[model samples]
Target: MHSINDAAGKILSSRQTVALTGAGISTSSGIPDFRGNNGLWKTYNPSIYAHINTFRSDPALVWELAFMLHDLAASTAPNEAHVALAGMERSGLLQGIITQNIDSLHQRAGSRNVINYHGTVDSAECTFCRIGEPVRRAALPVCSICGRTMKPGFTLFGEPVPPSAYLEARNLASYSDVFMVIGTSAVVQPAADLPFIARENGAFIIEMNSEETGLTNYITGCFIKGPVEQTLPLLVNKLNRRN
Candidate 1:
């Protein structure tokens, strides 16, 4: 396993550094990842609850899951890993972050240049009227303006990620000199392609997770095995000491 000092050295020497974050990063903040052993998917079948088809046909059924997400986002706070990334951004060590989590914890932790690749749970919008509003605790949320059914800001399964977010994240990946993959197994597509893009562009890849991910053997140059909440802060402290 590569050390945190090694990851810190890469970050320090890189001209442009970017991060790709996943559900694992926010797990420390009390948000359960969907694919882990104890993830919400074990309790709730994602095909039924997270599919756009189900959401469009049976909005109320989908709202059951949405309401739970709303509550979780409301109750949770950004953990040390999120804070460490934000600190890196503030100090100009990290250029930006591209996150697959729907929870807006990175932004809450003060990361300014975050691209929410999976969308966010912080707001809702009407499909008919396109008017956006804050997420509320309702069995079935509706748009006040057009009285149409509301959907959470997150991209449900079968829904396309917003084009702008995809493009921006791609650009960040293509230009990074150091790319960090944090807490994600990175099995999902489009977002999963980012590490490869960085590698193609000559970015040194750093992987930080509790266990080895698919990228660990493939593109990862430095594998720092541990919980990101612990590993990330350690890396940041190393960078700070150097500074």
Candidate 2:
């Protein structure tokens, strides 16, 4: 029930504040969230397009989806929400961002300390040699050394998160004084556990989303309902005034 200004005050006062972001944060940039009313999952069966098994069996099919995503990402630009978070980090009010999104919008927005909890589309990795190459939208990106067909670096369904990213996100959540959940419903496992870990470690939890998520009542200390593009800038403005 706390206002955006109250949340901003908490962020400014906290010694260490971290943001956990998801597809919702990127929606303003025209990226679609995975589980919303118009989410990608609702249109495409994840098992067929986004599962590791599907990738192994039919990488070409998976690449079709990948190319579609790449095109979408290419056409989009970082929105105000992303810019605000990056500004917060630059000002030292926010320590870092942990994101479930595969798009590199946060990085594009100039957030230096970002943990890509769900990996990213910045490159494609060889399934055999594990070597990666920068994504090439004209055709499937391939590894230079082994010439193996490369897969997008994103964490596909049934694939575990990269260990280093997972550990860093967990450590941040455990050590933060304030943890903000932006545009995520907090239903996905592993990443969803971060807020609970933060709360248990005595960090205040804040949520900003267009609708009530599963964790809205259970974990949030402050719930500010709205689009992140609108809400985050207001919060940042409040923080700036306090500073």
Residue-wise C-alpha lDDT for candidate 1, range 23-135, written one tens digit per residue: 88999899988887999999889999999999889988778888888788889999999999999999999999999999899999999999999888878878788787888
Write down the TM-score for model 2.
Answer: 0.95
Least well predicted 10-residue stretch by lDDT in candidate 1: 134-143
Model 1 TM? 0.95
User: Candidate 2 lDDT, tens digit per residue, 1-243?
Assistant: 579987987887899999999888998889887776898888777889998999888888788888877778778899999999999999999998999988889999999999999888777888789777778877767778887778988888888998999999999999999999999887798998999999999999999999998888888999999999999999999898888
Which residue pairs show backbone clashes in model 2?
A: none
Best-fitting candidate, scored by lDDT = 1
Q: Where in model 2 is the C-alpha error above 4 Å?
A: none
